[model samples]
Target: MTLTSIPIALTIAGSDSGGGAGIQADLRTFAFHRVHGASAITCVTAQNTLGVSRVDALPSAAVAAQIQAVVQDIGVQAAKTGMLLNQEIIATVSEQVAACKIVNLVVDPVMVSRTGAQLIDDSAIAVLRSHLIPQAAILTPNRYEAQLLSGLEILTLEDMQAASEKIFELGAKSVLVKGGGMSGELRGVDVWFDGNACETLTTQVVNTPHTHGTGCTLSAAIAANLALGKDLRSAVHLAKSYVTTALKYSLAIGKGQGPVGHFFPLLLSDS
Candidate 1:
């Protein structure tokens, strides 16, 4: 029997039909971390490990109503947002989050795909910065998302530090600028910056083709850890470690940027 309590965490985001990212990744991460996971999908994407081909957003009111339904009935200790496609959806989510007073919000600014597809529009970025950033407990942005939000090119560690500062200035309680995309020679670098201090998280980057859901998985793991009562910094640290392990154990599953093994530990134990 498991000795852990199942803390509840919610994912307010899009649905990835491929099961590699978006709401799919959130649920798997929650299960992996022993959280009772709940989700309200805001958008649906026809995506695969290969790439995103089509997107159909849910009505903003429906999205808002689903969030209300989940929070009112089941409740969540922590929540994370991924793939919030449009401004209306962003507003709807922010309104509900405010009304429910649900703290511990982790926002993954998923703007572009690794394969060069634009996952989010420029307008959504403005809405995210103006609305969601202030409400979020943590903001997770990759190099490109960081540049778009902070108006700084995150080429070096110094630029990353400045990006974190600008992100916090936009109102996030804490920021995680994922340096997974930093230029040549730096394979592994992710940074965490709280309002008070910053820490650089490094690992031997897994040179694998299967990294499709890294951002979603990392943010969800952090939310799961937070739901389990870990402090923000502790949550981020553990989440980063978890993502690294997941990537290390990844299976090359698709034609393009494939999925890491979200259930690696479970598979290992079953073996």
Candidate 2:
């Protein structure tokens, strides 16, 4: 029998007790793409589909320790960060990045949840813009987050393009502004600005309420694809497809908004 080595991807994010978004989604997305996932949790969020009720951040030292443990031993090919809510954690992460020099960083600027709860403090926006965005290989921000980062209302596709450009100007080498939250039939169009040209990644919007963890999943899936030796564009394409597929088979679990079935492809259907 022959055994092949699976590449590792690290996720530095908060924990969602609901097992829907944040670290849980990241791990599942990694598994789906056949990549090993290591996690260094920045915070533990207390909430479900309804909304994020509370968030308790981990100490800077502890966060650094987790990243160090993974980097010094297990190692990682690529890393994704979601929900780094404070400056201290973000700064600590930046220091670790300089120390480890792990390439292929996908930063999901998770400022607010889908339910409008503040995942990050307003003061830390500057920290993220100056520190984290520059350190990332790619920045994935949704429409609302793009607006928050770029200070532009992403009302149309053109606005998304402008926002992506603005975000890149803020230091993101590459930017992908997810169009899921935008009103109207955009087909969940996502705009990617790679510092030179704009690429539109469009997929039919799935009519599923189980849309939580999508940003986390996309970022994680992109990391997984990168670990498997795929280039940036291919990685984003595959990640988008994976997220769409996951949403199509999402399980309606919670009362407010459930989760997309991470292992949906393996689920046995009644049909």
Tens digits of per-residue lDDT for model 1 on 121-191? 77877788888889999999888888888888777888888888888898889999988777665445877
Q: For residues 181-202, what per-residue lDDT tens digits would candidate 2 score against the true structure?
A: 8778664899998898898889
Please identify model 2 stretches exceeding 4 Å from their true place. Answer: 1-4, 115-117, 268-271
**Which residue segments of model 1 deviate by more than 4 Å?**
1-5, 115-118
TM-score of 1: 0.94
Name the lDDT value of residue 135 in candidate 1. 92
Report every candidate's CA lDDT.
0.87, 0.88
Alpha-carbon deviation at 90 in model 2, angstroms: 0.9
Q: Top lDDT: which candidate number?
A: 2
